[model samples]
Target: MIYLDHNATTPVDPRVVEVMLPLFTDQFANPASKHGPGREVTRIVERARREVATLAGARARDVVFTSGATEAANLAIGGALAAAGPDRPRVLVGATEHPAVLGAADAAAAAAAGPGTRAERIAVHPDGTIDVDDLRRLLGPDVALVAVMAANNETGAVNDLRPLVEPVHSAGALLFSDVTQALGRIPVSLERTGVDVAVASAHKLYGPKGVGALVASGDAWARIAPRAHGGGQERGRRAGTLNTAGIAGFGAAARIAAASMTDDGRRQRTLVAQLTELLVGQLGRGAVELNGPVRARLPNTVNLRFVGAGADDVQACLPQVAVSAGSACSGGGDVPSHVLLAMGRTAAEARESLRFSLGRATTPEEIRTAADQVARAVQRVRSLTQSTPIQDEVRDDNRARTARPAGTPA
Candidate 1:
């Protein structure tokens, strides 16, 4: 299959795998152990921490490894809320945030409720960009944290976070960003942006899954409480045995991403543009609507809505191409995309949308083939709808059967 769902997850890079192989075999000793083998393993883990910190533009000391972005996000939100005392109990989250952020914010609020503690959702513009003005209106001294993503997983919309730093800091609130989709695709400097807390998964950047990091500033860490307790691992912020192999791969991926992101992004942007143009050209501009900003988006991502065609049905018709109607984390539900709905799309329009995310491994030939196949599938589905509305046909058949006399045949 032609994979175009890099926003969901990427195939592990072979170079990253090569670096991790030795750790799983000869160097399998636990980092926490106090032996010669353990000291060597501990050294490797610290090196990986530095590599990850470099990518995130954070200090090595502030990097805390976790299972993945989901867990990192939970620890960041929950820990911050827990430490925020009863005076500052409000948490503001973006409307188009990933499920991890939304769910974590809800759980954190529920777990840390006081008299007025709650989680509020910030709104987004029609172009899928966060509404900074709306966020300013929502900010207050009582707000402890603001959760916004650096880039949207579905639409690839990039947020201008610089404007938010002043407002959030002035209100005595911390800025937390979920940078899972933005880390490798774009230049995200947590230190430069003054982002207090940021989370990213290695799998999204061509590393192994089950490994990620929470990069928090010195002040941010001071405001967070430990979520897990055990052997005092991760400096007591996250308590668990480190996955040496996965962490090694994650560091390698970060190093590679740092070196090659410029070239990879340029090439992927060309491919994505070609694929998008091919579809819109074949289907006509009116029939296909772009969901996010034309610019200021990830070079490898695109979300499009095919008018009069259900995204599920279109996806079903194109079995050879791997794409998503929405986020993989949302599960296989018939519900409309919350991201699109929050961006002013109706439920029907949201159902008609699909996201195609390219990667470094994606080829021009694959783009050509995927475009042709997807365009044909959309046309076929639209034709079927025109010829016989499936719902109407089913209803008509039911009425005819009900009206027929029972057991009329002799």
Candidate 2:
């Protein structure tokens, strides 16, 4: 099968596996223990922390390991709200944020014991980036946190976070970013961007799954209370036994990504362009519409709407080529993409969209083959549907006027 769904998860690099194997067999002691074996494992965990921190543009002491980005997001959002108390009982999250962030904010607001916190959504532009004006309008002293991701997982649209720092800080709120999709695919400098708290998953960057990090500034940590209480691990911020093997693999992945990210990004960007051009060329421009920004996006990702063709039908036609209709976390639901809906797409338009995310190992040859297969699948699906030619044209025109400007080519 031709796998084009790297956004869901990536294959672990062999080098990362090599780094992890030794830990599981030879050095499996708990990092929290005080024995010599435990001390040795602690060193390994610390080394991984530094590597992850370096990639995230954060200090080593600021990184806290978690099971994955979802857990990290919960810790960040829940902990922040818990610490802020009832006086600052509001969180402003991006409308297109991952379900983890959105759900965390909602759960925090609905907490039974604490003073009620409200979770509001900041609107997004048509191209999927956060609307800073809307964010500014929503900011207030009562707002405790603002969540705007660095890059969108479905559309690959990037946000210019520097423009938001001043406004968020002025309102006495911390800026939190979920960089799970942006960490290795694009440059992410949490400290440089003034993002107080950021979360990333190792699996997104070719490391083992079940390992991720939450990097926060000193002040942000001071405002965050511990969610999990146990043996007082992770500087007392998170409590659990560390995954030594996964942490080592995460470090190896970060080290590799740091050295090759630029080259990898450049190569993947070319492949994505090639694939998109091939699809548009074969399917005709009107039949295909770009779902995200034409620029200021992740190099390895693209989302497109095949006009008049349902994404589920297209996928069913091309079983050999793996792609996603929306966020993998959505569990293959028939529901329309909330990200697209928030960006002004109709339910039908959202269902017609498909996401193609490339990986470091994706090649020009695979791009050509996948493009041919997808084109055939789209044509077959369109023909099978009973819509008339005039209806298709009208739908295509409406999509162009709403989703993309009239002059722009798909």
Which predicted model would earn the best lDDT? 1
Overall local distance difference test of candidate 1: 0.93
Best by TM-score: 1
Residue-level lDDT tens digits of model 1 in 2-37: 999999999999999999999989999999999999
Pairs clashing within candidate 1: none
Worst 10 residues of 2 by lDDT: 385-394
The alpha-carbon RMSD values of the candidates against the true structure, listed in the order shown, are 6.5, 7.9
For candidate 2, write residues 1-410 as lDDT tens digits: 88999998999999999999989889989888899999999999999999999999999999999999999999999999989998899999999999989999999888824555689999999999999999999999999999999999999999999999999999999999999999987888998989999999999999999999999999999999899999999989999988889999999999999999999999989999999999999999998999989998999999999998889878876657899999989756679999999999999999999999999888889899999999988887778646545345545654666688668776
In angstroms, what RMSD does candidate 2 have relative to the true structure? 7.9
Q: Which stretches of candidate 1 lie over 4 Å from their true place?
A: 386-410
